[model samples]
Target: MGYNTFHTEGDMEVEVEVEEADQSASSGMAKQAVVENVALANALVKDGGYSWTSPSSLKLYPIIMLITLNTAMNGYDGSLMSSMNAMPAFHDYFNVGKQGPATGLLFAIYTVGQLIGSLFAAPAADRLGRRFGMCSGAFFIVIGTIIQATSKDIGQFMGGRFLIGFGVTVGCTSGPIYVVEVSPPSMRGLFGGLYYSFGYCAGALVASWTCYGTGKMLGDWSWRIPVIIQAFPAAIIFCTVWLLPESPRWQIANGQREKARSFFVEYHGNGNEDSAIVNLQMEEIERETNYDKELANNRWWDYRPLFSTRDRCFRMYLLILVGVFNKFVGGAVISYYLPVILDNIGIKSANEQLLINALNVVFSSVASVFGCFYVDKFGRRNLYLWGALLTGLCYIPMNVIAALAEGHVAKGTGYAFVAFIYLYGIFFSFCWMPLQTLYPAEILPNDIRAQGFAFQELMNGLASFINTYATPIALQRIGWRTYTIFLVLHFIYLGMLWWSIVETKGRSLEELEEIFSDPHPVKKSLEKHKIVLATGQGVKRKPSSNVNDDGFGNGCLNPRNKESLEKHKIVLATGQQSKWE
Candidate 1:
């Protein structure tokens, strides 16, 4: 077989691109996986002149599904309070009216707790393992849930909300990092989007229906039951997290090299230590990890590089914008006070509002699933821009219909406003939900992934707090005109995303470093990525034993060991049906 090479490191390097069009001697299970995702066929690499194969994605399903429960736990808490606010029993017990500034503070305090928790999320994840951070968060949620369930006063209930928000901050921030690091490069978008977005929406769906069922009950048990149910997911995560594999990338970063290798082989490689995919993944991780360590700065101050350059600063801006707009545009108002929004649109019955809210979440969850299928396929830029555009356009008619309904200009305008609300959820799910969950983790580098995510959580909490706190006052005063503000803001968000957001689909995490490091990131990202895609080979030089004239070892970045390198070179001789020996 013949192969072409591209120089990856400095000078002393070779990159061979070989298209053998041959089948490898592989197990049935491995071969089956290769047939599924066609992109895996072209990902062959040569290490030390030896051929290597990639790993199967089938092994990733169990852990990805399990970790998503954490995100759903956060989502459940987010919507539960909104649903609870609809019940008269809850209002009577808390002694707070449904539509007022005091009600907004009660809701906003949870976001304050999340903001405080975000301050510690990075340190916890960086020092302890991903599993430990997640379990700790889960434990806190259980404590908070018990307090809320038994709360006798408004202050006690608000305290419970704070704890749940704080605990959820830890889980939501770390959970995505864990998923992104462990997932295969080809499937990161789908898995990340599905678990974070679709999973969260599913939890919201459950909360809506649960409140509907319990709201019909006679006493405080109506709201108390939903508050208590929040603990179940956290408990499941706390109990079973220990059994799951820790993030392989985190293991390697913390100097647990052998453990990292072992897990990569057993879980990612399916017991094949010599698998080409496993070796390439390990090599990339090692190289990046070592490069980051070369700086030797492990303190919180190390994150200064995230804004050292124009490109880096732009990325940070996108992240902050993502956090802010995700909550503010329409989601915060709809999610935190849907009953109030419906009330303004003339849907007077609380039960009717709760049932419609349940259906709205179900539809949004279903739409999120559809978006997940093509998030990677269509790329991030298109989804963000178009999703924002469509969602914004939906509001124009909604605002007009609601405004005209007040003047008795048309009959059944209330139902029209409700339809637009459901449509808004659908559009938001299609565009914003998946990307909001996936982009922050995707854009940040490995060394600062946890820290960057912490910043995002901080912004998310601040924005949610502001929006949740101010939404009730706005709804109480201006009514449907509050939508016009979001409508205008969506256009602003759409323009910024179109102009600044970089596409990250189908690229390796390591490759992204090069893209963002370039001076003209928005312009050069696509161009630089072409080089990475063209080579499709990752090369590392073996260490040499030569001594120099100055009595120092000749340590080169790309070592030249002719004998060892030739020994490592094993060719693929293809027959009528090409296969590896």
Candidate 2:
């Protein structure tokens, strides 16, 4: 029999079919089976009525705002300690001398804490749920900040800073993933960018204000006050996240379809003309079901496929390379060392250095805002390539000035460096910051998205850890030469950006699976051989409907029949040949 079709308010329709059978026993049973199939399909396709009246009507925006707030606190806690280091109380309490190891050690401990936090965030979020993971991290921050506030010695203060770093690490890892999952396809980049942009802005504001207000309060409580202030935000986030919905993707993966549906409707609204939320629950159910079926026998260890073959191996390597290099390319070093760098260049007074640092924050925050506006429009790769280029160019003059000058070079050099720093901040806010935040959320498949991002964060934390401690030592040993090192590193980053990085600007989470499935060869010899076959056949063949040319040379593997499903297993398993055409 032919399939029957029913129309909905939009052009969308549900197609159904029921096969007729003969009166014979076998045929009768077949007929009944067809009837059952028809019934189930009908139910799946039925119009549930518009639950989402308008995009603006959904409560999701408020929830997104909350996540942004939490993210801001993370940024603040992560960078605040850097600015505080210039305070007399912190310098005295820590026994920090100009460009001393103790100074590096104090700041480095926080990154070490972040490393530990990143290692645990994924499994915790997966097993205990996102809310629990977030709250647990927040709790850690509160305790850490409290200790930091009360610490009398450098060791105690280091311990507290580590704790705050650990907590904020969790927020950094989980917050973007959570936000990306809940957002609509069209608004994903905008909302996701907002989280990082606002977070960085708030962080800059905190560091600036804290330094400006308490620069002279060199008593025991001076630096402690900022550390203590972090607790309030943590406390608020800890309590508020409890009321938010667990990720619908996570719920569906755990086989809670009805609950996922309710969440999608309540927060996202039902798929109605007036509602902005299109109920993707049914689509997700089907997609996840297919994914589960495809990987039914797979185990957690199957993640080996991520690095099994040459192509898969290359992709993983590229991701790690970019992540690790991104950190070392002087973002963390600049962030942690900006005040000292300024002071060395003869800004003289601590207050002047603090003011310049504050200006850095303001300019970077503004760049972040502009980045949010154009990220989706310009695409990730465009921003990254140009941003790295501009940032690299900005570093050149600073390095030259430092290398040549005996004292403050010239007033003009200082002006040039200051101008370059703000431009660098803008470039960072627009390109590196948002791109780094968006990459982990968009590059990996659903099953491994959290795990992959955690690993990315681990790399970031490790880099930061090394930079935090090693920066002062490097500066001490190299003196003005440190700028030369960063300048070289930025060029390397520019090369990587032009070569391997893929554009994932406005794609959905489902769409990202396809984007990263195949490797993009940067080397000339391998580029020609990297063509993916549609049906595993060696001969050149027509591209399948599931494969889309993503404007990159390689084909993007669309998740045909699998994008909507919630499966716990990684999408690709070792020993299973890739099915992309």
> Which candidate has the top score in lDDT?
1
Cα lDDT, model 1, residue 347: 78
Q: What TM-score does structure 2 among the candidates reach?
A: 0.78
Model 2 CA lDDT for position 389: 87
- TM-score versus the correct structure, for each prediction: 0.82, 0.78
Q: What digit string (tens of lDDT, one per residue) describes model 2 on residues 245-310?
A: 888777777677777777766554443432222333346444745674564423433446455445
Candidate 1 segments exceeding 4 Å error: 1-58, 300-305, 407-411, 528-581
lDDT of each: 0.71, 0.62
Error of 1 at 458 (Å): 0.7
Q: Cα lDDT of model 2 overall?
A: 0.62
lDDT, candidate 1, 393-502, per-residue tens: 98889778767755344337777887888999999898778887688898887777888888888888999888988889988888768888888888888888777878
